[model samples]
Target: MSVDNISRADELVPSRYAVPVGDIEVLVISDGVLPITASTLATTTPPAELAGWLDDQFLPRDVVDWPLNVVVVRTEGRTILVDAGLGVEFPDFPRAGQTVARLEAAGIDPGAVTDVVLTHLHMDHIGGLLTEGLKARLRPDLQVHVASREAEFWEKPDFSHTVMPQPIPDVLRRTATQFLNDYRGQMRTFEAECEVAPGVLVSRTGGHTPGHSIVRLESCGERLTFAGDAVFAPGFDNPQWQNGFEHDPEEAARVRVNLLREVAATGEALVATHLPFPSVCHVATAGDVFRCVPAVWDY
Candidate 1:
């Protein structure tokens, strides 16, 4: 099961939402949604509390339809793609992995991309690049940037600190291995931070994975940060709630809290992979915890 691989024009409804950060232009595209167990979202919270929070958000009690988002940026004569989204190979998640088709629907050619910035090597982030439909279209000199530590971590990933449903771990390893082997030549690994364009910057923030990173867009006076897996839906209301997929739960919480505080203070827009569609918002403090203030939709 997979999303329709037909021509792009068939998707009449808009799947990509546009936002402006001064001179830079960004499009937050939908990669569809992933159905995940509700418990995985707040691994450490008491079941009752988790259920209560879900109820507050009006989400289901058992399986939750988690939104998957990827971003695209245009700046300094460069076209940059953030994360690749869950590619079409995974049969279990038939609705997801729509990055390629949606990219086309947005009038973005797969070959037009000049660079790709991966927040991590997780399958959901890098799998779209592995599909032959995309592989056959990428430019020969396309640059794929990732944190050095992230690439190294996948060599011998440590899952002892994490918990995931059965078969997921194995699928992740296989997909990651395939990605690295296929694109190692095109990859450009960075140590701390790198600028993809005049206004687009990606910096490593270890927690979700040893090399998990976030992208920051700054132009003129506007700022926006793509937190990747650092912040989930439960994160603002319960910053300490540990996500089961985090390689280091404690550090993930620290990362989430700090990132939330930063956005809340600076009043910058934030987006992430698993947050709701488009996932564009500003953060504000609500006592010790935080609150997600959804940005007013532009147009």
Candidate 2:
């Protein structure tokens, strides 16, 4: 390639997708990929069964790269950011934590983000806010919207049921603590459900964490659900398969099943945290299981 072409390729591919939910503008920004043990994704499934599923999907059997996705919702006069991606603080995850850069490339100003809706206090969800780079650019009046139970859970998070790596639990605890300490003054706790903006609703699901939540946008006649961690890539195919990241795997699975059914019934689009990049898709019931029909790119 010529030097000019190379130099001009800074962000030719913005790695972001925009979908309009009626009048509400939704942008799904990719935060790159987070690598995790493949086994962890199917903690409740048998080893052979998990391997078969992975092979069917043409995915790696050991380490799998999860597509980390975040969202920006513009409704009325307010700009809301969904869950923050993995930040740049941990040298361990170099490929992840590209949320801040991608946001800037998409022409979104952090200062204009009036509120941040956190699904839970998991490090991957809240680490971006603790980053020195993004934190410095955000406005002082930014309101961090989280479920009241979520904030309380992080105070004494119970990871007994999860199957994450040893070092991960400690790191998660530390990151969550730091995030709360830094943003406590801006916290806006909500109960079961609250409308953050016009037609944008966040409700506690309480499966992945005690206060894990999901954001739903309903405007005019269109609808979309940003299902934080309540839904994952494998969730559509095996809604009963519990994930290791879930604080309560059984309840998490139940929540996943119910959410999938609801989305399928309503025929609204679904975006998830660990689904494929720009994970905008419609759900369809496949007998007992469900399917994610990827939405056409809206250019």
Candidate 3:
């Protein structure tokens, strides 16, 4: 199939994946649709060839689920939402809009939000920031933090021309501009690892985005990391396998290799943006190999 055909196919299916993490209960809220197509999933492989490969691997018949898993973290005194799922409006997409609703379902109020730390400014990650009128959708007064490096990358003069899908850059530009204006002084950015809270820290993990970040939660000797799009699916047995959508596949592969090693060595439970619903998994290493063993949380 052609790339255009694959893009069309991806618009159909979407899945929501999440898991509860530590005292800071985290959920992977879904927004938008996820469709698996030859180009989006395995662009390098010929459409027919990739179809055969996926079939052999026992993946969905011809498509893999392309759901967006937005991470929401709930903490005491304040509710922290990692990435906002899509709002009710967008040109061509369906949203769960459950970020706040689900939070309410969990007994969380939108006004209770104290901080909203973004992993990056991608549409799926930041779209939940507002309603059509620019009103704060989730938590109006929430402090929205984005990585400085990422903010600077797309803001560059040549970034628009560099992006593969032009809409990706355009969306970021619109969202950031609006966020900067609406949130104003509430917007804060960091360059490297900084403790966002007593037990939560944000670490820079670029490659997927120029300034993509992952959140770390350390409490009562239990440490958990919310890896946003860094390790998509553990999709491949090789921990180093790179996804097709990565901004810099080589750099992304390297980051995953290192992360897998570190997570395994420390035996930390991680919540990934895309891993399968309730995406909490622990890393176990055997010699040079690392595996993601999904863990069942008591909560």
By TM-score, the best candidate is: 1
- Give the per-residue lDDT digits (tens) of candidate 3, residues 38-143: 3455444456765665677578645566556666666666667788766544645543433444544445556677888888766667666664533444455668
In model 2, how large is the Cα lDDT of residue 114?
93
Residue 83 of model 3 has an lDDT of: 82
Estimate TM-scores for all models: 0.97, 0.95, 0.79
TM-score of 2: 0.95
lDDT of each: 0.91, 0.88, 0.64
Decoy 3 TM-score against native: 0.79
Off by more than 4 A, model 2: 1-9, 12-14
Q: What is the Cα-based lDDT of residue 211 in candidate 2?
A: 96
Task: Superpose all Cα atoms of candidate 1 onto the true structure and report the RMSD in Å to 1 decimal.
Answer: 1.4
Rank candidates, lDDT, best first: 1, 2, 3
Best by lDDT: 1
* Model 2 lDDT tens row, 1-299: 11111121266655788899999999999887878999998987999999999999999999999888999999889999998888778778877777777777777878889999999999889988876756778989999999999999999989899999879999999999999899999999988998899899999999999999999999999999999999888888898888888999889989999999999999999999999988889999999999989988766
* Pairs in clash, predicted candidate 3: 17-277, 18-278, 34-66
